[model samples]
Target: MDDLVRIHDILQHATPESLVILNEIFTSTTLADAIDLGGKILGRITAMGLVCVCVTFVDELASLNQATVSMVSTVDENDPAKRTFKVIRKPADGLAYAMVLARKYRLTHDQLKERIIP
Candidate 1:
């Protein structure tokens, strides 16, 4: 059985706890598998009224419930390559895609202006 499945089984049978911390439980799974497992685990956690801190790349998890809050690591506006290492609680707005594209294609404001004017 997969490690995530085993962990889920364990969590299901364990006594109700106050806090649960899960770190990247979906790391080794495909997108579909990750969503399935994540949803199940989150559902169980919510049913038990347990406080959970789940680290995930799946942004959909943030909207799963009112109790679920999201915080994202941010980068500096002045330096796209520099990570501020600060986590701010907010809804996911798909801004990370813009940042990735900017870095990958050198699409920063200054770079764009230089290319367009020449």
Candidate 2:
């Protein structure tokens, strides 16, 4: 996502979904701790070899209703790798946060760092 043009286009067309995205990303066990210890959950995911990383872009979710967004890398059962999701506090457009925990997975520190890098 380093390409500004692509990033801009994503921002333009991106519409965040409701917080349910978070539910789909992490299991009920992990979801219980997502909001309280978001950092820890993220760390655990990375330790598990997943790529649920945080991003720092202009978030439109906030504009919808003081909502906050968190980026994640969830595992896809149907696929071999993980998928990214934008976790939002409130529901908005048709887009929902990416579910990185849809499947079992983990990510190393280097991989986590790469995803966080701007």
Q: Give each model a TM-score.
A: 0.69, 0.18
Q: For candidate 1, what is the TM-score?
A: 0.69
List candidate 1 stretches off by more than 4 Å. Answer: 9-17, 95-118
Candidate No. with top TM-score:
1
Q: Give the range where candidate 1 is weakest over 10 consecutive residues by summed lDDT.
A: 92-101
Worst 10 residues of 2 by lDDT: 18-27
In the range 51-79, model 1's lDDT, one tens digit per residue, is 88887778777678877888887888877
Q: Which stretches of candidate 2 lie over 4 Å from their true place?
A: 1-36, 53-118
Clash tally, candidates in order: 0, 16
Count residue pairs with overlapping backbones in model 1.
Answer: 0
> How does each model score on lDDT?
0.78, 0.35
Per-residue CA lDDT of candidate 2, range 1-118, in tens?
1233433343345343311112222223343343334444333333444322243222332232212334433434475354535343432343333333322343555556766985
Per-residue lDDT value at 17 in model 1: 59
